[model samples]
Target: MRQWNFRYEDGEWLASTVPPADDNLTAAVETLVVPFGENLQAVESYLESWGRMERENGFNYSLSTPGAVARRVSKESVEICDLYDQFEDTRIPEAEFISLLRALSTAMRRGT
Candidate 1:
């Protein structure tokens, strides 16, 4: 059997190890692995929390999509509340949202 170790780079997938296929993924995992993103229940909780946050932030857009994405994120992995708080300032501007997201994404990587 053959096994492949995957690493994501530049918006694409990369295989670092070309090993014989085996039942085990490997002796160890260098990057972390999770069967699920953030647990469903956690995401739900985050959604509810975000709704309350939206009210305070004045961001009226439907949070349904963001809530869904939150499902893929571990609650403990991200301080979603922090991002929400930043949104409350309004001074960040729409263009800066992407920068904030990038920072938050980096934070997730670090926390994970």
Candidate 2:
């Protein structure tokens, strides 16, 4: 099975086969590993939780299209764009997106 490691690099998200070395970083960073598979339900659940968090925080956003891209729609902008922009890949695979959402959901659930 193939796995991809995603990390925040230079204010953007980058996916690569090899994990970044500790000596190459300045601060602590979390990485998500995505395994290839079908996980539609997981993706949906993550999106729902994500939307809920945004709504609770008073930000207007929407998950749209077959690609499932989440975008901010409100005039009052937030840091979501910067977060999304970190995803360097033009087309993010469903499994990868689900992994990201799962991490976010877990963080939210833990109240961290």
Q: Estimate, for each residue in 33-72, the C-alpha lDDT of model 2 and write its tens digit.
A: 1211134455456577656867575545544433223444
Write down the lDDT that model 2 would get.
Answer: 0.38
Q: For model 1, state the Cα shift of residue 8 in Å.
A: 24
Clashes of 2: 1
> How well does each candidate superpose onto the true structure, as a TM-score?
0.23, 0.29
Candidate 1 lDDT over residue span 1-112, tens digit each: 2233343344322223344422222211111112114234433444456557555655433232321222112222221221222221112133222233333234335432
Task: Identify the runs in model 2 with alpha carbons over 4 angstroms from their true place.
Answer: 1-89
Measured by lDDT, the strongest candidate is 2
Q: How close to the true structure is residue 16 of candidate 1, measured as C-alpha lDDT?
A: 33
Candidate 1: deviation at residue 13, Å? 29
Assess each prediction's global lDDT (C-alpha) against the native. 0.30, 0.38
Cα RMSD for candidates in order: 16.1, 12.5
